[model samples]
Target: MSSKRMATIMGVTYGIAAIMPFFVGDIRFIMHILIMCLIWAVVASCWDLIMGFAGIFSFGQVAFFVIGAYTSAILSVQWNVPSVVAILLAGVFTAGMGVIVGLPCLKLAGPYVALVTFGVHMTLMPVLRGEIGIALGSGGSQGILTIPPVNILGYTFSSANQIPTFYFTLFLSVVCTVIILAVIKSYWGTAFLALKDSEEFAMSLGVSAFKYKLMVFALTSFLTGVMGAFYGHYIGMLSTRMLELDLFCTLMVMLVVGGIGRFPGAILGAFITVTANELLAPLGAYRAVTLGALVVLLVLLLPNGVMGLWLKRSDAEA
Candidate 1:
């Protein structure tokens, strides 16, 4: 797809999100969902950039997110740093972790990379719940319970200011989306495509496979980290529960339903999955089952995900 076409979809999505609070501003529940949709959209888009476009099979997105959340929460709640500064610092911390993990892991085969990254996810829970995390003000099992809301200048964004929070999140999401799109159209993106086609060949053509992968990995980690901090501040809490399989699986469902490698599809998928998952709340315990069955049906019916419905074979994934 043309860059313009790719951007149009996101533009339209953002346009819809921009006006959502006008209609549902007073409905806290719906407003909360909208806020989550924006948050998840950017996070999912970052996942798409990694697993979909860059073809990195890392499962550490959740870990990176929780890392960011806890990092910011500890900085603000325990150390007295400003919420805004903490969030950016959280991104930097996660990106550093990404580099550390990616350094050796990226040299391995695809499945091995997945295992190593997922291993990071698996180990994070213990690290957070154990003595080490508590020393860093993690709150251990109790989790951080008193994270302050994001305060910009004199204005505060929190549950009390749902509409303002939504727009603020929208602004952040838009910035992240623009960066993702730019990366997709840049040489970094083209480098990934070449590497995907054949890393050996791409390397011969002067593309640094490991470098490009690491760069994108760090970039996505940074974005996910920022959003994670945003989520923590918005919710006024942080917990290890985010590491559970349910949220991880929901992220996978977003990519699966949105079509792996599809740019704007990630955005669409996050909205659809989050909203649908909520709508199924009345089913009680059957919600996960229904979601599983829905994913299976969608995979069988729409192999390319929802984006496949619109993009042609010759079209670019982004």
Candidate 2:
């Protein structure tokens, strides 16, 4: 997508979000959902950046997110660090973890890469509940409780100050969104598309697959980590429950519904999927089944997802 076009899309997506509080300000549940959508949109966009654009079949996004959340929670609770610094530190830590994992796994084939990444997600539960986790203030199996809200100067982004929290999250989301858009419009994005088109040919054209792929992967991990830390602070706790396949599948649904490789679509998908998940809440246990069915339907009927449909219409009109 052209820079101008993508910017317009982001503006609209975030524009709607900016105005959302005015209508639903009284409904705390809706406000909470909106905040979550903002949070997940960045994470989902990062996933799209890697898998959709860079063509890396990484299944470790949730792992990185959980890592970031725990890292921030531990930093503030155990070490007495400020929440702002803790969030950034958590991002850096997660990015380093991504590099550690990526340096080895990026050399593997697609499915193998997915397996290794997914392995990270799977093993995290035990690791957090073990001795090492306790040493780092992971709270072991009990998880980190009593996490303080993100405090800026004298202000706390607690639920008690919902308006400020909403705007605060939105501000972070905007920064991440602009960064994602900027990456896609820059040489890095061009290189990623080249690598995706044909890694061998792109490599022959002097694109270093290892160099570009690993860098973008780390960048995505960093963003996901930051948002994850925000979530931990906002919720006031951290737990291994985040690693469940159910959450993983839900993240996948965001990408699939948005149209993998589709930039703003992932953003839109996050909003739609988060809201839909809430609607499906009444279904209780059947929610997962319903989401699975929805995915299958989107795959078979609209393989490109909602973005694909929009693109098809645009093409026809043109």
Candidate 3:
């Protein structure tokens, strides 16, 4: 099929898959997977906006993710604010943090920026644990529990009702992804791609590389924070563990295996990785081994990842 037609087909298939849990006997299990995947899809796609288009390799994306969840949770619990308003405030606060971090690190690039961000993520973990953060921030290492479920539009969601949460998450993920994709295809996206190729060159062309880089950083932060809030509400808890280095590594692997720089690759990577993890659950000790082996094989044999290989072959034919 032509690429456009293929994409339409895939989109429909995914939409159906998102709602399948409600009809299937294992509604809870399926909903868990779909909702988790949708959340990762949002955060990972947001990460791609910087890593793929802006060429900013930030290891601390999770810092924003955790901030969103913890911030919303604390605000709701401590201030007795509604969850809806808390979520919005979480995004705003996280985006501000992104800009604060971006300002100094904006002049840095590549591995250097990556290292700095990694440090930032690490530093936040302890604070969230309440050793430095508000005892309310992370509940003093016990983490936030009893977080209010998302309630809006006359709809109420709790942990027991998984299907509704899954659909809600899926809708938000789709919306965020579409917005990011639209930006990438617009003048701003062109400028971002140019900056990715060469910051000096993009600036030479009067692209205001600095301004666009900051914009991408803040936008990414907002999206990532929103996903984090969804995760916190769905899981009914928020902890530093949710934003650990291992999780970031998993995200990196997914992005790499799915093909960095391709939007669909982010979603594809999340699905494959999540599915593989779930399927391998029965193998116990062998699960980690098998996953590592598969990743190694995929990297060694298909270095550009699945989507990258397809694009390369298509280019060769044309």
Candidate 4:
């Protein structure tokens, strides 16, 4: 679809989501699902930048996520800064760290990059707890609480009103999606894909492999950091444990099930996975079993995720 048409469709979808609570009697539940899905959708999209587009799979993304969340929380709580400023700064901070991490870590690809990221996560887990965290007032093991919700203009958004939080997240998510799509459609994105296929070949074609790799990493890190910051505010907390391996694994599963190289695949994966988690919440003990079954089914059946299947059918029809 053309960019204009795409924007219109997204705008309509977001409008529906933003006002969905009013139609549904259970505003809390609706908001919960929308907010959660939006957050993960952004994260999943950022994952697409490294793993999906660039073909660099790094598991330690959550570490940068935690950094963004903690940084925004600390700044808001201690310095009394606006969430917007905090989010922007968090992106910058995370992007800077991405360079530090990417330079040495990007040197290793495939499973090696994933291992390095896992190691990074393992190293950060301890430092984010108790006294060490207390020095930074991160609440460490206990996690930080009473985090301030986003305040825009004269309006304040707390956990009480779902509209503001839902809209805010939706806006950020859409913005991230647009930014990513734009980048991917550009020569820079072409460079990323080139490197993914063959770094040496990309360099030979006048594409600066190092430059594009670093750029993509920085861009992905910035978006991930923003996701973390918004998540911290919306959830009203932050912790080291929340940035666990299990979470990344689940995210990776979502991406793989969604279709790694495709944009729509990543989003469709987030939506389906989030919806499944919510719908199965009532199942309690059986929820995990159900989710596993669904994943297995999707892998064997869809294989390329819902969007991937749709695309294939479309192509076949054409």
TM-score of 4: 0.91
lDDT of each: 0.91, 0.90, 0.78, 0.77
Separate clash counts for every candidate: 1, 0, 0, 0
Which residue pairs does candidate 4 place in steric collision?
none
Mark the regions of model 2 whose C-alpha exceeds 4 Å error after superposition: 312-318
lDDT string, candidate 4, 87-197, tens digits? 789889989988878887657868998888777778777887857778987876888887888787867665677777777778888889888878887887788888898
Itemize residue pairs with steric clashes in candidate 2. none
Span of 10 residues, lowest total lDDT, candidate 2: 309-318
* Residue-by-residue lDDT tens digits, candidate 3, 1-318: 134532553386367767587577265776787777778877887887888877888877888899889888888888877888888888888999888888877888689999888888988877777566755556866788778888897687756877777777878888887777777777888898898888888899999977998898899999898778767776778767866666887788778777677666777777778878889999999987888899999988866666655565653232
**Clashing pairs for predicted structure model 1, backbone only:** 1-316
Error of 3 at 82 (Å): 1.1
TM-score list, all predictions:
0.98, 0.96, 0.92, 0.91
Worst 10 residues of 3 by lDDT: 1-10
After TM-score superposition, what is the CA distance of residue 159 in candidate 2 from its true location, in Å?
A: 2.0
The true-versus-predicted C-alpha distance at residue 251 of model 4, in Å, is 1.6
TM-score of 2: 0.96
Best by lDDT: 1
Candidates sorted on lDDT, descending: 1, 2, 3, 4
